[model samples]
Target: MTIDRCHQVLTAIDKINQQDPNKININGEMIAKELIYGHQMTACLNKYWPTANEYLQIAVRAQHVKRWHIARSTYPEGKQGYLTWRKDLGKMHAELAKDVMLDCQYNNEEAEKTASIIRKEKLKRNQDSQILEDVACLVFLQHYFEPFAVKHNDEKVISILQKTWKKMSAQGHEIALSLQLPEHLAALVSKALS
Candidate 1:
């Protein structure tokens, strides 16, 4: 029963993400960006923490649930705007995941627990929340860093990398170091660390 409910919630989250209008090219195929991102998050979580509890698994999958609904352009252009947008997105994702969990017949307590993980409540203090942060950072480094590094200047990329590094745990740093990034991208990461 527990496993069934967890699978139901995960499937529902995937269904919602599949509606993403934005597409990303993956190997010669265009795929829904958020859907692939959810999968990537799940893969990272399973790879690094296969024994993760169901709430953590669900939270990871729902981290960016329907993210494209909130356009970054809707917020102002400064750092404050970016931070606000991120905070809003975290709230939205938490609420959406909570709703999905309830719909899947999870108790309110269970739903709220998963939502808190999605909101990253007590990030450094909460083990599940910290694991979620680690998985997100790992996924970003493995899949998104190259494209992001290509677009931004070295200084900006390094700054962003530094911020990302700060959010990750030591275990996450180890996993990130194990990734086989392209040579140029590896150099950029080295520069960022240095």
Candidate 2:
């Protein structure tokens, strides 16, 4: 029954994400960006923390739920804008996930826990939250880092990588080190750490 509820919620989230007009080409197929992002989060969670509970799984899967609805350009063009956009997105994702959980028959307690995880409450002070953060960082490093690196100057790219690295757990760092990033990006990541 619980598993069925989980699947229903996941399906609903995917459907909402499928409405996204923005798309990315993944392995020759055009797919909704957030849909692929959610799949990547799920995959990273499973790979890095196989025993993750359903709450953590749900939170991770909905990490970027309906992200396209909020465009960064809607805010002012600066660090404050980026931060505000990210903060708003986190709250929006949590609220959306909670609504789905409630519709799926999850009790308020369970739904609230999921929302808190999605909001990243407690972060480094909470194990589950930290795990989610780790998965997010791993996903960025594996999939987005190269493109992000290309768009920014080396100093800015390295600074962002440093921030990403600080958010990750030691295990996440291990997984990141094993990833085969392109030569230039890998060098920047290495330089960031040094």
Best by TM-score: 1
| Model 1 lDDT tens row, 46-85 | 9989999999999999999999999999999999999999
- Candidate 1 clashes: the total is 0
| Worst 10 contiguous positions by lDDT, candidate 1 | 183-192
Residue-by-residue lDDT tens digits, candidate 2, 77-186: 99999999999999999999999999999999999999999999998888898999999999998888888887989999999999999998888889899999889988
**Cand. 1 TM to true fold:** 0.97
Q: What is the RMSD, in Å, between candidate 2 and the native fold over all Cα?
A: 1.1
4 Cα displacement, candidate 1 (Å)? 0.7
lDDT accuracy of residue 79 in candidate 1? 95
Clashes of each: 0, 0
